[model samples]
Target chain A: MKNLLKHHETYVLLVIIIFSAIITVINPRFLTLENFFDVVKSYSFIGILAVGVTFVLISGGIDISFTAVATVAQYVMAVMIIRYGGNIFTAFLLAAAVGISLGLINATLIYFFNIPTIITTIATLNIYYGILIVISGGKWIYALPGWFRAFADIRLFTLCTDEGIKYGLSIITSIWILVVIIAWVILRYTKLGRGIYAMGGSMNAARRAGFNIFRTQMFVYSFTGLMAGLAGLVQALLVQTVAPNSIVGKELDVIAAVVLGGASLAGGVGTLFGTILGVTLIAIMSNGMTLMRVSSFWYNVFIGLIIILSVAFSAYQRRTKAKRAIAVEVE
Target chain B: MRSRHSELIILGCITTAIFALMWVFNPNQFLRIGNLQNMAFQLPELGLLSLAMMVTMLTGGINLSIIATANLSGIVTALILTAMINPDAPPPGSGGIIILAICAGLLTAMLIGLLNGILVAVIDVSPILATLGMMILVNGLTIVITKGYVISGLPNAVRFIGNGVVLGIPMGTIIFALCAGIMALILNLTVLGFNIYMVGSNPTASNFAGVNNTAVLIKTYIISGLYAGIAAMIMISRFNSAKAGYGESYLLVTILASVLGGTSAAGGFGKVSGLVMSLIILQIASSGFNLLGVSAFLTIAFWGFIIILVMVVNFISAKVLERKAA
Candidate 1:
């Protein structure tokens, strides 16, 4: 029981349950399947990005340029589809390719130039966004093809309520779930996944263990780039428009969700389960606040408090645990 | 010390080169007093912000909340100014009232900094996450107070600090110089400054040497907050208005300037003179681009390229030096 309670995911799950209970109590409507689908569908893109970022964070590197990569990827995909009449497969391919290349740019800069990950990403974030803005002239890509818009409406399962409203699990939400499952498999079973954890835990130790640092980093960043591209496509489909600057500043939200899910920014400790819970908690919190009729302005304040509190709680827990172990050894 | 000197000299040469190039490209427009003063007026806001970022980075941490703190401080001052003085009434505003407003604004920024310090230093939260949270919280508060509207119509006295000239120099530039000089002294001559570098470079060694890392970090962030507060005053005074989202773009530029000036991102090892030199270089390039009618977006792209180029140059030079030593 104690070991189970000590797990970070346990605490995250507990918070989700308690918070959901509170929200449901305040507004019973929040308990419905419809709202559940709504929240998950709407936040699926963030979920995808969070999952991708979890890999990088677990590899002990930070990437802030993912959002910029997403923006550029989605913009290019949208432009191509609108200009040349490509299908969904073409869209995904274009976004993924663009994302991979951009991600490689980040990796190369960090590897060859020996620049810090955060610094390289920050510089690249500006470069990518500036180039996009210069080329696109800050124009919004509208009038997307009907087929692309139709893809968003596909649902896996359908349910009908007595009130005659039909709701189903959205394709975007399924995509998020698929991404999560894939990431879990990669982290749990793959050698590359183990290498990522080892590297994040201690880079020198991992290097001594014969793990290819360069290949691991290349894979990590490029994977994130690929995810960002997909997320961008998901975003464009959901919104039905692509705005040049809409996606860049929200990098913090995704980072917060990942961190809140028990991913340490210091690197090497996080879980896919915790990340999903974190994303859910954030989505529900925002959604519930809207249901509760709270001022929208207070949203950031609450998120900030939650992030600080959770991280502080975990830090305190770790310190106490270390002290207890030390005392035990002395005894 | 030798490396620091060389870094500054190299930065100086680069700044001079950029300046000469701007003059050569647009000889008539680049050197006009009006344009010069305009650049002078603009340089201080970013300069002060870079200093704010540098102090914390010196301790191996970053204060992402600097822009938020500035905006919040500016809002508080604007709220006070607007509340205490009526625009249509006689005796526009008293000196005491203005001073009170300024103090209140600074106080707000300091309190936010204190929160950041406690979270980062005492609570052991990472600096990036802590400040990022503070940034969001403070921004939310700014929005709630301002309701997403601009607070305009400030008294002339307050505006003077941002727009007034002092003996051929803009008041903003003069103030920036004073602050930069004091900052240089703090980093060079004070025990706290020494401790900051020690803690940043290696916290374990510093702690074993009897330096209080927590206190130094807290003090460092508070000082960073104070700089942000000063920046707020200049920003509000110059714009004659305050808003929740002012100067959002300056956040990244401040980091760019710091790194270009030779501050390592991993912390420990930066010089105020180097930062100042880099800031001048950026301002000149920025202003020069404006004079040359280069697209603003392209200028941003240029800044990004310059940062990468600087880092690459530094890396290659370090490697060459290492080989020579071997």
Candidate 2:
């Protein structure tokens, strides 16, 4: 129990539980099974994107172009299916390829040029988004194929509500959970994951220790792109349409959630469990705001405040931990 | 030769070439005084925002909250004016209330800057995350107060600052030039400015040299906020309204301008003259594209492309210089 308490994820988990309890008390409807599933479903997209970003952040790099990559890849998938009459499998395959291709572009720039990841991604985001808009002529793809819509409806279970019915679990949620588990396992058990963490710890040291920086960066960014691509498809399917401009600005939410969940921007830190809890906390915050009849404008205000506070708290914790280590050394 | 002046020379050459091309292709539209005046009027808003970005970048920090600060300040000033004047009546002609409103807005921006500075300098939060949070917070507050509606109908005194011309030049352009001059003076002549460069180049060395790093950073951000306030005033007057969501696309462009102007994101480098030339180059390029009947969206892509090109050139030049030295 003490060991568990020592972990950063525990505190985040505690916050989520406390927030959920308070919101449930304020609005009894918040505790309903439907609401739980609703939060899970909504955060699934962010959750999937966060999985990839978690790795990047842990690897001591940043990727803001994920949302753009996702948008373009999703658009490509949808356009191929709608225009070229491709199958669902072919569409997804092409989407992943596009995602990987874009991610590799970001990776290559950062790796070869030694430019900052944030700056490179910022430029590429504009390039990718601009090309997408020009090619599509800024048109909204509202009507999607019947099969595409049906893909999201692959339900694991259903619940009968007093009003009518509710979905208990769907493939979307399953994918979200599965991705988290995969990220967890990779970070904990894989050599590449350790190399990423090592690179974040100290680039020079990692290089001296025979860790391949280029390969690690490529894996990190490409993996993020692949997941963003998948998340893009899921998001489009959920919305039942594709508007190229709509999905481009939501990278902040993912970054904020990841940061709130204890992912350090300085790298060499972060965990899948903490990321999940962070996503849950953000999802509930928004959900609770809606339940309390608060204006949506306040949502951004709260999110900003929370991000500042949580990071401050974590910094404080690290300071105290460092002090304790120094005292031990003195003894 | 990979001299220090080479980038500037390259930038100059590009600007001249583009101007020559435009003069040849669309001489009538591109070289007309009326069109030049329009370009001058439009340049300052982005130019001021870019200056705000450049100041913060000097401290090796970024203030993503610039547009949000501008919007919030404008909204605050608009609210004050709206409360004073009758909703249905015509705007008052007196400039007194307008001055006060501008003061109030500038004060709000200063406070926001102080908060941002403290968050980054004192609390030791990453500048990007700190300013990013501030950006969202300020934007949300503005939306909540204005309820997503545009605050139209400002007094005429305010509009004059945006629309008024002085000796064949725009008042807005003049204001932008004055701000640039002041920034250049501060950077070149002031002790605080010297410390800013020292601190940015090496904070540890600056600290060892007894430089007040925290104070310099705080002051730098405050100046950035002040620039944003003036830009907001210009923006509000030009549009005859203020809103929470205006100029949402200026964030990245400001960064692009600063970088293209030779402002190193790594700190300890940049110049006002370079920035002016870069902004002009961009304005002409964008307008040139528009004249050719290209889509406006392509301009953004062009900005991104140019930044990459500049980075590549800078990288290659640095390498060549190193090899020559070796």
lDDT per residue (tens digit) for residues A55-156 in model 1: 999999999999999999999999999999989999999999999999999999998889988889988998999899989999998899999989989999
Question: Each model's RMSD to truth, in Å?
Answer: 2.2, 2.5
Over B132-191, each residue of candidate 1 has an lDDT whose tens digit, in order, gives 878888888899899899999898888999999989899999999999999999999999
Model 2, B1-326: lDDT tens digits are 24547888979988998889878888779888987998899999999999999988977889999999999999999999877865456556546776788999999998999998988888777788788878888988998889899999887667888999999999999999999999999998999889888877889899999998889889988999989999999999999999998998888789889988987787887888889999999999888877877777787788788778777777887888889889
* Model 2 chain A worst lDDT window (10 residues): A322-331
- iRMSD values, candidates in order: 1.0, 1.3
Overall local distance difference test of candidate 2:
0.87
For candidate 1, the lDDT comes to: 0.91
Residue B311 displacement (Å), model 1? 0.4
- A1-331, model 2: which lDDT tens digit per residue? 9898778888888888888888888899999888888889877988999998899999998898999999999999988888878667887798789999999999988888777787888888888998899889989998788888888788898887997876688778887888788878888898888998999877888888999888988999999999899898878867888999988878877888888888888999888888888888899999999998888989888888877777766777777777788553211
Listed per prediction, chain B TM-scores read 0.98, 0.96
Using all chains and alpha carbons, the TM-scores for the candidates as numbered come to: 0.97, 0.96
User: What DockQ does model 2 achieve?
Assistant: 0.63
Query: Which candidate achieves the best lDDT against the true structure?
Result: 1
